[model samples]
Target: MSPNPPSSRALPPLVRIEGVTRRFGDTVALDGVDLDVRAGEFFALLGPSGCGKTTLLRVLAGFETPDSGTVSLDGRDLRGVPAHRRPVNLMFQSYALFPHMSVEKNVAYGLARERLPRAEIRERVAAVLATVGLTAQARRRPHQLSGGQRQRVALARAIVKRPRLLLLDEPLSALDKNVRAEMQLELKRLQLEAGITFLVVTHDQEEAMSLADRIAVLDRGRILQVDTPVELYRHPQGRFVAGFVGSNNIFSGHLLPSGGLDVPGVGVLPAPVGVGSAAGLVAVAVRPESIQVAAADAKGGEGLLHGTVLDVSFHGGSSRIAVTVPALESPVLVTASGPATVTAGTPVALSWDPSSAVLVETEETTWKTGGQAT
Candidate 1:
């Protein structure tokens, strides 16, 4: 089956992976994977190290083949196609520019190999260079440019081929934080202007969230979820997805008599409506910013749980406070704006609307409400 259900639109996906599995020795790198990337879309394969994201990208680029399954691009099966013969370009993280060659020559390398006319190659090279905002640096060698400029050169080289797809492996991993952020925007803009489908492999959740139209979260050779960044962050389908895509304060609880969650020692927290009064919910995840914190002694309020502040970290506009609550196995993290008026060892109260808590399903025994065994 496709990773996602067929869309209502009639346009076919530009790239497709069906039941693809790759294994090395006794280890499985990809397990029965299926995916569809739409044309002109900026898609991301996001996961942590050893998650087989890069392996899948390599498979699409023709550097590696799945042990069992098929990959196709623009309606053609790529089973027997060699890497060079495939109409896809893979850009490495290192930028891989030739130090001895000028920027324009580097960008024209692929076209030269195809034995294109010199005038056509020059025209394409110049046009792509200008598209990437690297026209001024055309005559400069790789060593003469900044890291971001070198990356653009590499991007220009890949796009000059006018390939059906462009595969990037950790494209910004080599840049500093500031430069990385700038390039993220630049890369997105470049993709739009070129109108090329980009499949980027990354371990950085924030990068994937910022650059991709849709992201596929992979873990241990399996896809956990595929959704827009906001959807994945706010409405994750399962526990793994809730924890992986963003930072969340997860509470383990059972269904309560009032249709809320009876979190062990913590007070009953309301669950989002429509979760059903089922006892199958084993956990609920709430973003730190969703919970409100105040001084415990100031007022007694409904839905409020008291705790002692364990630590507070300030990050310009927001502060991350960890509070030790008796009902929780670990400190509950809260992100608040304004001053850090609450310090370590201070008593605080945390409260949040039930609507903010997301039910996360897990493989746990179900317990009925009122502490009754079903």
Candidate 2:
């Protein structure tokens, strides 16, 4: 088996979820879920909507009781603890700032509810406001501040309690594209400075990849894969993860005995040499950026798949080229960093190193030794 990318941090898990199950009537929102979040490392539970990420988050928050299994924080069991009693804070996507109150007041409300001293509350609020870069706008109401600033207010309010774990539910969904991108960086920085374990639930792959040190991909009601961002993109273990995490050109074929994938019409695609007797049907996933494409003069043959360039889209730093191969059902997507030389409707040749292609199986099958999976 190939080695996976090392996690950035290897501290002990601050939050441990074991055999957790939640159901609403006949619908099972979470099914025997297990996960561990390292101390002070930013983590994300990522999946599509209704994938049970929210239910897991609610379970941790004590809002939804699990049907079975146990949840522990800092080695302490949280079976019957109430939401407010737990050492965790949840920041909603809505920001949910009090419209009538100023930014400082909104943040200070949580502390005031706990009946903290006046001097201590003033000092902590000032410090957290400064940390989130909202000191100048402390007195300004949420209605008076920008979207990003209001988000900071909500975050500051959550972290003000110095909670051991901070849960963020679709934290950036409210912001526009540009502002959301900016806040991603801000959120990462805040997590580091606050020195708290931040576990965010987001359906956005980009957000999870960019913000979290490690991410758990949830599907249906089960955890599909938990890995670092780079590892998840570079080495997806199964067909579902390959299709879900990023754009992949997947080719379904049978594993050849001679260490190659046998597509019915495409001949044998190269797999790693010395692959043992593992055979049968499998899917090969090649990332768009991994494949190389160039214009073909006459009909480039020999270890190359000839195709017609269908589309070339320039996206700032790179251009995405789509080529339709005669034997393939889907276009072979390729990414080029330089200028877009090949125009649409031009003849092209698609080729990539054997190492660039990954042999992927369904979620239920064992990993086969071939292609990149080797």
Candidate 3:
């Protein structure tokens, strides 16, 4: 068989944000946030509510202006560009479809406003409808269609303008679980087909993890960290990133001389980084999968902590167990490959490789009462 073609890498950024800051009265919405969205790449701004993700999207779409700093697209400053004149389109969370217009008319609305030729407008609308798989429902109104179908119509409308950039503000938040998954795949395919830079804003970590080429995790109007999904998960910069990205078992304690954090129950467990005497408080983060349960005598295992199985949950492919170690205030979650062999109230030895645990800077918002750091 012929060798498969190499997958395409990201091109240079087409949109750039430099020291962007936006404020509403005394409240800062975006605080010196700097970001770049590469050509044809799907980038996501991820954070919880009031984190400035939506504000950044609005800035990019020309719906809002920054109080300080600059917004540029293709190296051109967008300070004076009005929303209607910018070569960008935004798909809102509400789908924002005109209830009075049919699917075909909604998709063609932008082109019609530009006063395009009659035949050309119809051709472009038909093309975008086909791309979003909405051609069959072209005559249906927004109320007549399902949530996912309405979303596709919105996407078709956004792309019909042939803009260089696309902005999506929680476009999939309204759909059900199954439809959300389907739309995620469809959106990825559409971005690849259109070759336009896509910037999405979402608080849903799973959506950002699944769809983004690179994610910018924001907090309180500041960009905390930006990296690929796997890098963000495997090596979080701090306690917030670790806890926000996925489930983690965190321990808070002082670093001991033996290159481990001295938790009450876990003792001196090996850590990924060395903490000198200068660092007073430290937190250790380890994914549930990194934890292992053995029969009290696993060879070559150091820093073994003995705990009793407090609870067990079967989650189809894997089993999750909450084990409570003596001297620890909270239970540590452990994941096993198959069904849970250990029952609640059973004694078990909980151990993990020293390399699996990541040492992070302690934050006040870390998990309370947990032996591990959040």
Would you list the rank order by TM-score, best first?
2, 1, 3
- Candidate 1 on 43-85: residue-level lDDT in tens? 9999989999999999999989899999999899999899999
Where model 3 places Cα greater than 4 Å from the true spot, the runs are 1-10, 256-258, 264-266, 273-278, 295-303, 362-374
Span of 10 residues, lowest total lDDT, candidate 2: 365-374
Please write out the lDDT profile of model 2 over residues 1-374, one tens digit for every residue: 11222553556679999999999999999999999988888888989999999999999999999999999998999999999999999999898889999988999999999999999999999999999999999889888998999899999999999999999999999899999999999998899899988999999988898998888999989998999898898888777788788788787667676566777777777665543344556778888888777778536654367889888999989998888777676777888896688999988877778787777663335433333211
| Predicted candidate 3 versus true structure: per-residue lDDT over 1-374, tens digit per residue | 01111232435568889999999999999999998877777888999999999999999999899999999998999998999989999999998899999999999988998999999999999999999998899999999999999999999999999999999999999999999999998998898898877889999898888888888999999999988888888888877888888888888776776676776544676674554353556778889999988644322343377777889999999999998776677788898998998888877888787788887566545344347523
Candidate 1 residue pairs in backbone clash: none
Q: lDDT of candidate 1 vs native?
A: 0.84
lDDT of each: 0.84, 0.84, 0.84
All models, RMSD in angstroms: 4.4, 3.9, 3.9
TM-score of 3: 0.90
